[model samples]
Target chain A: MELWYSEMHTEDVKFSIRIKEQLLADKSQFQQIDVFESNEFGRFFTLDGLIMVTEKDEFIYHDMIVHVPMATNPNIKNVLVIGAGDGGTVRELSRYKSIEKIDVVEIDKLVVDVCLEYFPNTSVGFKDPRVELFYEDGLKFVRNKGSKYDLIIVDSTDPFGPGEGLFTKEFYGNCYKALTEDGILVNQHESPYYSSYAKSMQRAHKRINEFFPIARVYQAHIPTYPSGHWLFGFASKKYDPLEFDSKKWNELGLKTRYYNTNLHTACFALPNYVIDFLEESKND
Target chain B: MELWYSEMHTEDVKFSIRIKEQLLADKSQFQQIDVFESNEFGRFFTLDGLIMVTEKDEFIYHDMIVHVPMATNPNIKNVLVIGAGDGGTVRELSRYKSIEKIDVVEIDKLVVDVCLEYFPNTSVGFKDPRVELFYEDGLKFVRNKGSKYDLIIVDSTDPFGPGEGLFTKEFYGNCYKALTEDGILVNQHESPYYSSYAKSMQRAHKRINEFFPIARVYQAHIPTYPSGHWLFGFASKKYDPLEFDSKKWNELGLKTRYYNTNLHTACFALPNYVIDFLEESKND
Candidate 1:
């Protein structure tokens, strides 16, 4: 007998995985959460029936998100991570010894509890002395704030449901106000291929562009994502990811499975169609 | 009520689409061919239950396959394409006026006939006077051949069925002998994420390296394929794609939907895990 877990990528498209067992399922205060074990993807979980992370490809997402900003601005000392309750983003961030303090604001404590109970590999770094876990709404935490963190990561979900407020222009304005002069913001911008994700991506980019002087989009290949083509947005007061100091990054000797010095430049090289999409998206 | 068509990405993973109807289904001499009309991916077709091409994302595959080599060596005159019955590669190649002759060899004539009847947007370039279609085995066509062509593209299916021979060392060596002094050979390299696809990718890369001094693997995000992370191998006698003449390609003024000058450099910048897999594959 085959137990299949399926998610609608769009109304017309769906992705399914055959699972060995349904490991966990429950309703969090914010949304419904389910976890399953599978052969191809190993262990995976979903929030509100949408894929959030898979054991096989979560490394790709975590690596691409945390490292790009850290590599772009090597002197980054403080970080504010929003909505990454699974602790994968903090896991990657904890690798940087230069980071003096790490603040993680997750709306759902249940997600973190489940992850710590199940995904030990990803939740490993949460115990770091520099890390602080805040059970609060990210929008409220960022709003009416004083100048602070050198880096902010919006490791969010789709634009609907619980993640809706995080993608707004008002939230972005607050994030800008909460950052130091050289602050960098990285967010899980949606994919460019499917229309649903593209619309969300365009809206996020347009909003972020209005708040930040330097804004760019980069891509990574995460097999379990809607299209396996995932994107991340980088917005900063200064630094361009393309001009990465590869020599310095190499000297840091961070042994990574996915993120590397060569990929630093490569991930930013969007296809012509994507480039055109962004241009049209900006205007549309 | 909803009608869904599903394809197994791996034994444990599958991708499905809500279909308006099955447009075409038949068993060719070589493999099973099925085409379906869908709202999301537009019109898509599968060979032996594996996706061959979709009207929505076929441009990504075609653009990457043809333009990468064309951009690498702008002066390529004579070209040979193997197993691209859909005519997308041929369509893109036909845009290059400098090419004097294009010889396409396909083992199955039925694939071509069906594609010509169905996928006209891609098959449109077959009417060009420069392209000569031959129904023959690509492996046999290149063996003991005179060095005539500057570029040989193996646009084949998975390394099973008729395409199995195309991935062998002997076939690559024959392709090496079939090219002019500055010849370039490009072929489909499978994905590196899933263990099943990774094995095929490793074998193809290892075999190609034996024949060509300048061999590299590049990636493209083709979401319809197994991993949405597809690869292409570039094995050349002389040129490296990174050293592309961007100015010259730009002067040619080809309006592409996918490939671009920046991406030409970026595609080769593979992730660390993929690079590691290739290295480990080489030794194994």
Candidate 2:
């Protein structure tokens, strides 16, 4: 028997993977989660039928998310990661020995439970002494805090279902309050290829722009995503990702699969259409 | 009945597009030529069941192929495009009024005929006075000349079947002889994310490196391709793509969707894994 796991990239587009076995299938109070073993992608897990983490290319996403911010400010000590239940974001954040505290906010505890059981490479960071996991809504978790985190990484899902609230103006305002004076806000900005995802990307960028002095969009190619062209938003109060002395990050010498000093500068160079679309979104 | 056009990106991974209608499907003397109309990608055509051009994102491929070299040395008055049957590459080249002549050598005449009928947006370049079309095998056509063209674009299919010979060492050596001292040679380097495609990419880059003093790889996010992380090779004797004064291209005042001055510089900055892989390929 042949089993395939498919996700509708759009109403008219689908991406599928031939599965070797269905590893796990269960539900939490928030969403349904499924784990599958595949030949091309190795092992992958999905939340509410959307691909969340795949062992094959999770390093691409995690590397881009954690390292870009970490490299921007090497002195970052306290970090806040929102909705990264699989713990890949924290795994990368844990690499910095200088980082004194790493707080992870995941609304679904089942995601952490599943990752702990199935995806050890990513979930291994959960055991780090500096790491703390909070099973609570990220929107609410950041509301109670003030001027705390040096870096806030919103490694969340698409802007719908449980992740919809995290893309709102109010949520961004709370995140702004919860950040240090030189804090950097990095979030999972959706793709620009498909119209549906591009709308969410624009909305997130627009909302974040209102809160931060420097708001920029950067891109990475993550094959398993809806569109391989995935984007991330880098909104900061003091540091410009491009203006930083990359020699500081290069001196640390992190062995990364995707991120590097050269790519750190290159990723922020947005395509002209994306720049035009984001510029238009600012007015609307 | 719902119809879906699915291509196995690898043995286990499939990318599917819902078709509004099957526009055309026929076998040429060389390979299968199929065209489909879709909501997301508009109109797209394939060679031997592999996607070659999609109206929605063809601009990205055509832009990167034609403009990068043109911008590097604006003095390029002569261009030889190999296997760009759809005429999209010629369309972008015709935009530069300084380009006095463009010779397109396509192996399959049928691919051009179908595209001319269905994809007018791309095939429109054939109407330009400076554009010349030669329906012939690019390998043999390029061999009959020496130091004739200012730029040579090997815009063929994958490194197999009809496009296989174009990736050979002998073929690259022929192309090297067919270029002027300052000529630039650009070819479609395959994706690095997949093992199968990465090997092809490595082989192509390794061969191209032998003939050119300066050979480098650049990437673009082409969503419909195998991995969406597509790569292209840039090779020249004297012009390092990085050292060019981009202000010359900026003065041309051409509007582009994907290729901008910023992206022109950034696209060359490859990820660490790709760099390491290419470096390893050099030894083998």
Candidate 3:
């Protein structure tokens, strides 16, 4: 018998992967977490039935998220990552020798615990001496922190459920207050393709735009996402990502699979429909 | 009670769309042709269980394929499109007043007949005075031609079945001979994420690279396709797409939903993984 794990992209669209076996299924306080083995994607874990990381393509997501901001401000010494319980974000951040501290705030300890057990490769960054893990709601963790982090990565889930608060105007305002002068804020901006996700993307971007001097949107093709067209929001206080020094980043010679200097520039060049969507999203 | 249309992306992965009704199911001498109506994608047609065009996102595919080369060299007066039976490619080409003639050679007449009947918006370009439809095999049509056309677009299905010859070395060699000195050749180069499709992409690019002085690959996020990360091959005898004048194309003021001056330049900047894949493909 074949066991197929399917995710409803929309109510009318579905993506399915044939799995070898279900490895683990358990409930955390925040969400239901499950792990499965598949031939096409290797091993993957999900939160509340939404795919978090698949072994085959997790590098694409992690590389884009961590490297874009780091490449923008190579002097980024400290980073605050919110909701990346799978530890993929932190793993990429630990690669930079210039980075002094990496603080990960994951509300669900069980998500971390299970990932460490089942996804050792993804969770390997936890072993780094510069990294620290905090089990707390990201919404509350940044409430009092003032001008602390050089970069903030809101590596989150869908705008509903536990991730809903992270997309709020208040949360962005706090994140702005919690960052340094040259701080960069990168978050998992929802896709512009589907109507529902586009609304969330619009809402989050509009709020972030209110606080940041330089706010831009970029895209990557992540096949497992709601639409394969996944977006990232890059909001900065002082630096524009487009004007970043590519030579400085290239001198470091980090072997990356997805993020490169040329692609970094290219990713920000939005399609006309997406540009229109983001433009209309501001008014909405 | 529920009807769904699913295409196996790989043996282990599938993409499914919920259908309101199956509009038509017929077998041409080439392949099985089917059309379906859906709430999400509106109306869509497939060949041998593969999606050709969907009303919702057809603009993305058509916009990228037709506008990129058109923008590269705005003086392009004539184009030869092979295997675009759905008529989306021809429709995009019809937008340019500079384009005097568009000769489309489609092997299957049924794809054109059914699409014109079921997908009026997609097939609308056939009504244009500039477009000339030839229900002949594209491989045979290019055989004797020598330096006749400015642009050749292979808007074909996957490199299998009736479309197989279009990806062969002989066909590409013929296309090379069938172009003007400043001629540009673009084709569906397949996806890079999946191994099987990547091999096809490699094989096609390897063959095309052998014939052209400037052969490069570009990408677009087409969600309904196998990986949503679809690639396009752009080969030319004279012009490098990167060196093209954006201001010249922008001056045309063609209102498009997906293609724009910025994206035209940006789409050519492919990911490092794809670059490495193509590099390795040279030896294979």
Task: Supply DockQ values for each candidate.
Answer: 0.90, 0.94, 0.92
TM-score of each: 0.99, 0.99, 0.99
How do the candidates rank by lDDT, highest first? 3, 2, 1
Which 10-residue window of candidate 2 chain A scores lowest in summed lDDT?
Answer: A244-253
Clashing pairs counted in every model = 0, 0, 0
Lowest summed lDDT over 10 consecutive residues: which window, candidate 1 chain B? B23-32
Candidate whose DockQ is highest? 2
Tens digit per residue, CA lDDT, model 1, B164-283? 999998899999999999999999999998888999999999989988999999999999998899999999999989898899999999999889998988999999889998998779
* Candidate 1 residue-wise lDDT at B224: 92
Interface RMSD of each: 0.8, 0.6, 0.6
Error of 3 at B255 (Å): 1.0
* After superposition, candidate 1 runs with Cα above 4 Å error: none
Q: DockQ for candidate 3, please give it.
A: 0.92
Docking class of 3: high
Instruction: Identify the superior model by DockQ, candidate 1 or candidate 3.
Output: 3
Model 3: native contacts recovered, as a fraction: 0.92
